[model samples]
Target: MARIQLNNIQKRWGAIWGVRDVNLDIADEEFVVFLGPSGCGKTTTMRMIAGLEEPSEGEIVMDSEVMNEIDARDRDVAMVFQGYALYPNMTIYENIRFPLRMRGVPKEQHDTLIKRAAGLVELTDYLDRKPSALSGGQRQRAALARAIVRQPHVFLMDEPLSNLDAKLRQHMRVQIKHIQRELKITTVYVTHDQIEAMTLADRIVIMDKGAIQQIGTPDEIYNDPANTFVANFIGAPPMNLIAGVMEQGTFTAPGVRVDGLPAKHDGKVTLGVRPEDCTVTADGGHLSGSVYGVEPTGDMTYLTIKVGDKLIEVKAHRDYRADLNSDASVGFDPKRIYIFDTASGQRLR
Candidate 1:
């Protein structure tokens, strides 16, 4: 049972702060993802937990013991990196058995452990082949098998699927999820891909500029974001944010007006609405604009509309058709609208 806790963790390099004041409690066997863009300190925080880098402040705890001063090898954590760090000279069987050999596990049990780990990743048939002989996906699977052979208390995976192509990445995502569930190990996955975080994590930690933006389940993060940054970052096309003024619960912009909003302090505010929440309507619509572009993705269509200077995307059925430069009216549920402070970018209740 591995329960990991990061308490007010901070990492600094001279005057630069890589990670700041991060506090999180990860339950035993829980899968948590550290998600953000590059240079946001997600990887730094994971490094601290793995003992690859020491925290400038606060504590790293596992179960009930402090691990800040412990060496990485003694932490019993296995890491899978974005690069498939397999030994090109060694066969897959030897690569998977390396951890067992390093840990000095009994020679009699090495064969069983190696085969079990390889089988979990479907690499049993490729055990005799060297890393150079396998494809990119197969090589990554070997790396995973190496980590699994340890059966450690925690798994630290840093963008393990980022190197794969889209389809392989999707395939590996499913495989990784299944393998984690079978192992039941406490896992900390770091990635900049929102789709991976949304699909695989039990909870996601969104971070930016060396600090956490929000921590919640995918549903909560997607349905109820904490700020404009989160609203803009998590979605595919991202949420449409229109700069406007709110007076007496009515929001008005250059080409948009939405009423029936929560009656709070009214002033300059940014209104946010997701593309999927918007639909093309002929009458009683919230906003109207000229169609800028239409994109079809086999299963659905994305229509881009120009509202004054801002462009808004609306998700439509695959069979939906629209003409470019044509006038269009789009409607959205007022209850689903998100309001934020213009100055601070914080959510307005």
Candidate 2:
């Protein structure tokens, strides 16, 4: 069992802070993902946990033991990087066996361990092939097999699926999640892709500018964001944000007015609504705008509307049709609307 805890963990380089005051408790066999844009410190925090980078402050404890001073090799953690990192000169079997060999495992155990690892990744048939002979997905599986061969206490994967094509990435996401479940290893994955984090993680840690924005299950993060940064960053087209003023529970802005909100503040505010939660109507809608663009993606249609200077995206049925530059009415449920403080970008309860 591997229960990991990061206590006020921080990483610094001279005056620059890479990660700051991160505290997390990862249960045994739980899959946690660190998600954010580039330079948000997700990778930095992962490196600190892996012992690749020393933390400037705080402690990393595994199963009640402090690991800050422990060497990476002795930490019993396996890492799969964005790059496949396979040995071009070596066959897949040899590559998978390298970790076991380095740890001086018995020669008699190598064959069984290697076969099991390769089979787990469905690469048993490709064991005899060299890395140069394999496709990107196959190569990544080989890397995964190598990590699996070690049977470490924890798995640290840093954007393992980023190098693959879209379909392959989707396929590998399932495979990785399945493998992690089968192995029941405590896994901490780092990625910038919100889709990956949403689909695979038991819980997600959203970070930005060396600080954690929020930590919660996928449903919570998507349905209830902590701030404007999270609301804007997690979605595909992102949440539509309109600058406005709230007075006596009524929010008013250019071409928009939403009522019945909690009258917490009456000054400048930002209104957030997701594309899927919005609907297009004929008349008497909450907001009115001119259709700027329409994109049909087989399953759904995304309609972009210009409300004054701001553009709002609404998701509609694939069969829905709209004319560009035509006036459109957009409406949403007041209960679903998110209000934020414009000055702080923080959620307004």
Candidate 3:
């Protein structure tokens, strides 16, 4: 519903920075996610956009209009919070209708708007119940209904699903994505969970140390991480990084060695490969290690191999089994390996 822009946005407290030199363009009706660890400034950036926090520098713009001087309520942006920010004393219907009433919508239109919002979020049955009467998922749905009733130009959600159980989170993720597509509103979601970012975002903005690390589709960022931080951060098992030395067209590390590699950069480097890319063998392969641990997760098994000072995670098939402390070897798929500069943590071709 609106195109959002953040230009060189920075926020600081005296000497410490919260968000630094952030520049991003959110397309009209696009679903964008701000992803990072706690204290990484993703929440701060979203807060700046919602007018909850004032930026120490730069501008926040919506639909070609600068929003720095605008009040949060006047900006026509609805925020759904992680804690569900609902009035505990009010019924679900009243909570959903709160926004409409605050914005001075006619009393007659409130019922229709509230009903539509509740129905969209599957909260119509619970509308007569107070928030305390509902489960966490139901409470979250009511919160979403509250924001939806406003029909704001921009939808800002800060980890709205974090409070739910794993199963409930999955269910709500689908609902949130469906609702956004149906409404076609420009939504900016913030979360520390990469799975949420990868699944829900049209494009993901990854931040670390109060700076944007990389911005791309889930596939791009996963397949081609800009740095080691992103490589390790994106995956559930995360990419395995082994310290090595690169010279000429070959790379060498403890228990691992590869040759005929692309000749781009040389010297000490770190090799990155996703857990799925590694195949575990009993004896010998590209690398050798000892089985540190084995975890069976129903559908698949996770093999933790200890190679000298490094631990490599291997996502093996479900039936795969290995004894702890047993000898193991790992074959790295040459085509899938990533090389990063050891000092800078930046990718090297």
Clashes of 2: 0
Put down candidate 2 lDDT per residue, 77-106, tens digits, no spaces.
Answer: 999989988888899999999989889999
- Residue-pair clashes per candidate: 0, 0, 0
Candidate 1 structure quality by residue, lDDT tens digits, 3-77: 999999999999999999999999999999999999999999999999999999999999999999999988899
Local lDDT at 211 for model 1: 96
Location of the lowest summed lDDT over 10 successive residues in candidate 3:
280-289
How does model 2 fare in lDDT? Answer: 0.94
Please provide, for model 3 over 43-93, each residue's C-alpha lDDT reduced to its tens digit, 9 standing for 90 to 100. 999999999999999999999999998888788899999999999999999
Q: After superposition, how far is residue 235 of candidate 1 from its true place, in Å?
A: 1.4
Which pairs of residues clash in candidate 1, taking residues 3 or more apart in a chain or in different chains?
none
